[model samples]
Structure formats: C-alpha cells, structure tokens
Target: MTQDGYYAVQLNSIEIPGEFDISFLTRTSNLKAGNIIFDSGTVMTMLDTDVVDELVRELTDFVSLPTEKPVAPHFKLCFAVRSTEQEEELPALWFGFNGQSGNLRVGPDKLFVWVSRFVKCLVITGTNDKVQVFGHITQQNFLVGHDLEKMELSIIEKDCTKLHEP
Candidate 1:
C-alpha cells in the first residue's frame, strides 16, 4: 500500500519471450526501485512507452492473427480472432517481482479482453508518462492482502469467482 493507503505493490520486471523460442525479446527488469504500482482501481495494466513498445513487438510476433487497427476506446493493441479457436492460440505472459515474490503467469484469457466474438484487445497498455501500473484484470482470482504494520503485501492464488460458495 502507498502512504495514502491505496493497495499497491512493487514489481521487478515484466517479460515476454519470442514467438518460437524461450529467449526473451522484451524484459523490463531494470526498473527504478519501487517504481511499479499494483493498482486495483485500473482495469488495464500500464507500462512505460518503451516497455509497451517492446511488449507489442513481442506479442505481434507471437500471435499469428490478423491485425486490426485499434478503434476508439480500444487504442492499445487489438487483434482479429477468426474464431473462439483462434483466441486460444495466443501465448502467455509473465510478471516477475523482486525478492520471493516469484513470477506470475498470465495466460491468453487473462491477457486479452473480448470486444466481440471475433475481436480481442490486449489488457496491457503503454503510458505516455513514467507510471507503471499493475491493474485489476491481472489480479483476478487472487486474494491480495496488505500488512501496513509489516510493510508487506501478500498474494494468494484462488478462484475469486467461487468466493460465495460454501
């Protein structure tokens, strides 16, 4: 959490590998200390322009789908999925954090938002400014806890959609 009491955490890096190889083409590991913010208020994650550009490059190379020009209100990276089957072909992404935070994997279903049955837009985007944000969509299915006294954040994986069940 920030000094103002917003639930936020720091990240060490965000990485996306090449389409056909494990070699990473885009890795934002050298971020300034405590620069990234895990924001619950935002719907989409945001990164610096250079980072976003590299991520776009890697994703474009990885996803073998027809490109669609970004339309209004969906101006990040958008693609045309021919069918439900095509949407399943998108590659996974990862977020790495400092210390024992480990790595968080984001699959295609979590990475893209379906605008239509045939159109899907990337949930990650670039910011004109230097603000790096970890948005809520990526936080789905996780129980996040903030310990103000200890100055620590705790994240536990769980099925958030099933929270109401006994």
Candidate 2:
C-alpha cells in the first residue's frame, strides 16, 4: 500500500524452462488505474534486443556472447479503450516496445495478460538464441527483509532511505 503500489510476495525459487532465444509478453489496454498491477503476465514473453543483453549480463545468472546478427531490444505498452459498455465495448490497448510503433494493433492478439503492474521490467536474452522477459513496466521501489532464523519478506510502505546499504 505504498505510493508505488507495492505488495509482499514470497520470493521463492522459480524455474523458467527453455529460457533461450526470444521471450514474449502480451500487453493490452483496458486496465484501470485503480486496479492491481502485474495482473496479466502469466504467459510467455519476448524481449527487444539491447535490453536483453543488459538484463542477462547484469540482473540474473545468464551468459552473453558475440553473435553474427545483433538485435536492438524494445519494450511493450498496453492500455485500454474504454467505451460505454463492458463486453459490447471492449476497448483494449497493446503494442510492442519497438520505437517505431504507432497505434494499438487490432487483430489476432499476440500475447496474453497474466502479469501484474507491480514489478520493474527488463528484457533478458541469453545465448543470443531467443529473447525473453525484457522487463516489466514497473520498478521495484524497495524490499525489506529480516534473517533472524528464516527469511521474512514484509511490506514497508514508508520513507526509509537512512537505512540503505552501501
């Protein structure tokens, strides 16, 4: 319940299988500002190109290498087109993070919405095979934990920069 809308989640070990080549994520409009984030990102995702390289080399434990053909990474933008009705007026918005994109696409959707808007996103590409999870749109504000006997993740919705680590 912080200003950035952060919540407590168990940072358990997760395994994304076949994490190679390109990753894909589906962003769409129709999301409300008062609604929860990252609510529609439980499916496969894609990364642009440069974002992929940086993400792999820094964020997670992945390997980067030289390639014959390099690609520039991009991001995704999703929104909604509100109308008068709900089902009869489903106005959705989703577009690739490519810098050259214009209007929202309308046709056979490319991805699904299973991600909440509560986490920072980055494009991660490993081995230059396929791009994956570029980055979410949200940023990770702060995470406070205690390691007395077990790891405990709590919700700290306040200002606490005086306790930052160097």
Q: What lDDT score goes with residue 45 in model 1? A: 83
Per-model CA lDDT versus the true structure? 0.69, 0.26
lDDT of 1 by residue, 50-109 (tens): 766777777787778977877655347889988778878776777766544567777777
The runs of at least 3 residues in candidate 1 whose Cα sits more than 4 Å from the true structure, single-residue gaps closed, are 17-33
State candidate 2's TM-score. 0.20
At residue 62, give the lDDT of candidate 2: 32
TM-score of candidate 1 relative to the true fold = 0.81
Question: What's every prediction's RMSD, in angstroms?
Answer: 3.7, 18.3
Q: Candidate 2's residue-wise lDDT over 54-155, tens digit each?
A: 434432333221111122333232223132232122222222222122122221122212133322222222323221231132212223333323322232
